[model samples]
Target: MKKTGIAGFLLSVCLLLAGCTSQNVDTTPVWQQTLPQTGVQMEVSNCTLENSGPVYYAMDRVDTDYWTEKTAVQVEGVPVVTLYGVDPEEVELRFVENVSYLYIYYDKVMPQPDLDYVLTETNDGALQYRLDTVYNYEFVITTEQGTDSMMVICHRDSLESANTGTT
Candidate 1:
C-alpha cells in the first residue's frame, strides 16, 4: 500500500511539471511591431436602417497610422472632440477630408462599446449640425459583437444647429 501511494505521488508531480511547460510560445509583441505606413483601403457600406442618413465606411484591422492621418483633417478647428467607451491609452485618432465629406478614424486597442447616447440624441433631431461639420464633430463609436461590426454615424451640421436653436 505504501509503494502504491508513493507511485501515485510521483505521477502527480510529473503531471504538474508537464502542465507548467509552455505549450505554445508566442514571442511577438502584443501590439503589432509595425503598423501599416499607408492608409488602409476602407469599405463603405450604406446604413440599413431607415432615416440613418449618410453612408457608413469601415475597415477591420486598420493600422494606427492610417487612422491618425484621417482624423487630423476631420477634427481641424473642432472643439471638444471626445472619444468615449474606449480605452484612451490604446487608441489613436485620425482626421481627413476631401471635397465630399470629412472622415474620422480610430485605431482601437480592444473591442469597446459604441457611444449610443450620442447617436440617439443627435440622429435626425435638432442636434444634427453638431455632428456633421468639423466645427462640432464627434467620434462615432464602433464595436464588434458576435459577427457584426456595430457603427454609429455623427451628423455634424444637425447637431450644431440643434445646439444653437437655429432652423
Candidate 2:
C-alpha cells in the first residue's frame, strides 16, 4: 500500500510539471506573429501658398500635436499631407509628397459577421465601403503655378464646428 501511494504522488507531480512547461514553449513562427505590411510613409513639398485652406490648417494642427506629444520633436514648417491608419492592430501615420497629400491607413479587427454585413451593404461593386457615418471635407488652393489640396476627415463631434447638419 505504501509503495503504491508514493508512485501515485510522483506521477501526479510529473504530470503537473509537464503541463506547466508545455505552456512556455512557443511553436509559432516569427513571421506568423508579425505582419509584413505595417507602418506609414510621407512626402511633401517645401513651397508654401499665401492662402492655406482649412484642410491645411487641420493637418498642421494634427502634425504639431502628434509630434510634440508623441515624437517629442518640434517640427519646422507645416505638413502638407498626413495619413493615419492601422496595420494589423498597429496604428501608423505617414506624411508625404512635399506635404502635398496625407495618406492614412489602418487595420481594424471587427467581428466577421459585422464586417460581412457592412461590406455587402456598402460594396456597390467598387470594393470600397461607403462611409455613411463620417464627415469629410476637401479644400483646394489653385495657384498660378499649380494646385494644392487639403482634406479633412473627422467624426461627428467635429462636424458641429463646420455647421453641417447631422442626424
Candidate 3:
C-alpha cells in the first residue's frame, strides 16, 4: 500500500512538472527579422539569399524543382521588394506598415523610351511601373507558366520614409 501511494505521488509530481514545462512556441516566419546587409548567401525557410557582387536577392525553387527559381530583391533603403522569374502579367507588393507607393514593372519587348515616364530596369530585363499609395501592401506576381508571391517587410521604421532610396 505504501509503494502504491509513493507511485501515485510520483506520478502526480511528474504530471505537474510536465504541465509546468510546456513551452510557448512561435509560429512566426524567420524572414520578419532584421536581415543581414552583408549580402551573403543564406537560407531562410525554403528560400535562399543569393549574392551577386554588392547586391543580394532571395531565390526560391518552388517555381521549378529542376532548374528554375523565383528571385526577389528589396529596393535598398526604400520599402520595395522586386520579384523576378519570368514575364509577369500581374504583380502585387505588400508591407506590414502603411505603404505609400507601390511599383509594378511590366517589360516592353522593344527598348522604346517614353518621354513622360521614369523606367528602372532590373538585371533580369524587367521594366518597372509605379502604383501609388496602398495601405496594406500584399504583393503577388503571376506569369504564364506560374505565379510567385512575396511579402515586403520593412526592417526599420524609417524604411518607408522615402519614396525611393537604397540602403
Candidate 4:
C-alpha cells in the first residue's frame, strides 16, 4: 500500500511538471487601457492606446467579425507607437483583445509620417494602406480556460503620456 501511494505522488508531480512545461510563454508586450466612458478594458499589442489626445476619431461600431469607425479614419504607426480612439457609448462593451491584424480604412486618410509603408488599392478600388513593416503578428490571450487567439485593427499619433496633457 505504501509503495502504491509513493508511486501515485511521483506520478502527480511528473504530470504537474509536464503541464507547466507544455504551456507556451508569450513575450509580446500588451498595452491595456480602460475606457473612461464605459469602464471597459481594451487589451492590445503592437501599439499603445490613449484617451488624452486630440480626438482624432472614435470607434463607431463592431460587426460580427470586424471593428470599424464612424467618421473618416487614420492609422499612423511604427514598430511601436501611441494610438488614440475615443467614444465609448457606441462601442459599448466591444473591448479589443487578441487582435492579430489591424486594418484601418478612413476616407481620404492621410499618409503615415516617420514610417515607411505603401498604400495599395483593393480590388474594389478602395485604398488599403500598409503602414508598418510587420504585417501579421500574433496575439496570445490567456483566459481562465486557456490561451485564446484574436485579430486586431487600431491607429494613433504620438502624445506625451497616457491620459496626460493633449498634443
Best-to-worst order by TM-score is 3, 1, 4, 2
**In terms of lDDT, which candidate is stronger, 1 or 4?**
4
- The whole-model lDDT of each prediction reads 0.28, 0.27, 0.33, 0.32
- RMSD for each model, in Å, please? 20.9, 20.3, 20.4, 18.7
- Model 4's C-alpha root-mean-square deviation from the true structure amounts to 18.7
Arrange candidates by lDDT, descending.
Answer: 3, 4, 1, 2
Stretches of candidate 4 exceeding 4 Å from the true structure? 1-29, 47-52, 55-167
Writing each residue's lDDT as its tens digit, candidate 2 over 69-132 gives 1111111122122222222222212221112323221112222322211211112221111122
lDDT of 4 at 119: 35
Name the TM-score of candidate 2. Answer: 0.18
Candidate 4 lDDT by residue in tens digits, 69-163: 22111122432321223221222111222222322222233233324333333354322223343232222233333432222333345422121
Best by lDDT: 3
Reference-based TM-score, model 1: 0.21
- TM-score to true structure, per model: 0.21, 0.18, 0.28, 0.20
Q: Compared with the true structure, what per-residue lDDT tens digits does model 3 show for residues 9-72?
A: 9999999989854523232222332223322222122112222122112222232223222233
